[model samples]
Target: MVMGFREFCDYEWFSFTMENYVVHILFSKSEPGPLLEGKSKYVELGGVYSAQLHQAHTSVGQTHIHVYARNNQLFAMNHDGSAHDRSHGSQIPNKVAQAITQKFPNFTLPKDNYIESAPSGIVNAFGHQLLLG
Candidate 1:
């Protein structure tokens, strides 16, 4: 089903183990629709975000990593944990990487490892097209 950003976040937060990795994928621009106040942010193309899973919370948690889109490029800002370096490059711990890879082979390490622009549709790394609605 096509999901709104909040619905997507809820699914990721509650449906997985704490050990599973999560990346908050943001598009460059907001899709045309009504966005819930304070819950969703409009994104630009090339905006990137990464976060290390801390204490698992089904409803709430700390926000980490904020990369702004500049000239269609993402530049990392100050982040909360060591998983990301100043370069905005990912430093995903080995164990977390392995678990994610095992479950989603299309999953790429270092959220920015690929050079392609983000796809407009919801598809995982394995090219599995997700029906967002």
Candidate 2:
């Protein structure tokens, strides 16, 4: 069984293959299909547990697509939807505040939305301040 992204409206069938004993391919579609177009490619998101995925995200500037985990605590990759990572600025957008706030209820922000303790240009990356222990 396969599901498609309604946004693309492309007709394509998903295929699942087991390369080795360690990988399981699920919820996949071909090119021009839903969620596979527009500067999208397979990437490995790094964090507590690594997961390979196809995510659409910006490489620079203000626009980006993040392939975050269901919990939104880990980062998969940022492509800027381009062939190269330099096509756009390499920084997480401020809009991520909304996503983080939804995930971590303990998250709190002062008057400013940006990371206050971070350096001038540096931010928390995922939004909100990281309290030091």
Candidate 3:
């Protein structure tokens, strides 16, 4: 099955992100609040996103989309927070970096550290310990 689609986020934040296509993976030490107009992509993985990259359709000060690879494959995280265990690679990021390079020859997608920092099976149940740890 070839998924020739675009746009996705972590399961916990999947539904919310759908409400607004703009993925705002936060890096600041802040909580998701009214200020976070988009899908509230938290700082689970400290990465840098250029405000110029995020596409249109949004009402916020900053904007950028989040893309990650699990087990060397790129798939949008579900809304149920089920995609927890896997290796995060730079597959999609490589593409984005290439696209940006066309215009800004000095662009590199910031490697997401969630898969690097968090242990296996920890990405899904982050902070939601009450669910099942």
Against the unseen true structure, what C-alpha lDDT does each candidate score? 0.33, 0.34, 0.33
lDDT, candidate 1, at 35: 30
TM-score against truth, every candidate? 0.23, 0.20, 0.21
List model 1 lDDT by residue over 31-125, tens digit each: 43333333534332222322222221223322333333332223322212223224433344454445445533443444433212223122244
Task: Identify the runs in model 2 with alpha carbons over 4 angstroms from their true place.
Answer: 1-92, 118-133
- Where does candidate 3 stray beyond 4 Å? 1-64, 68-87, 93-95, 102-107, 110-133
How would you encode candidate 2's per-residue C-alpha lDDT over 3-120 as one tens digit per residue?
3333323243334335543332233333333344444442333332222334332222232233444444233222222212332233333444444344333434322443233333
Residue pairs clashing in model 3 are 11-78
Ranking of models by TM-score: 1, 3, 2
What stretches of model 1 exceed 4 Å from their correct place?
Answer: 1-30, 36-87, 110-133
**Superposition error at 133 for model 2 (Å):** 26
Clash count, predicted structure 2: 8
Q: Using lDDT, give the best candidate's number.
A: 2
**How many residue pairs clash per model?**
8, 8, 1
User: The CA-based lDDT of model 1 is what?
Assistant: 0.33
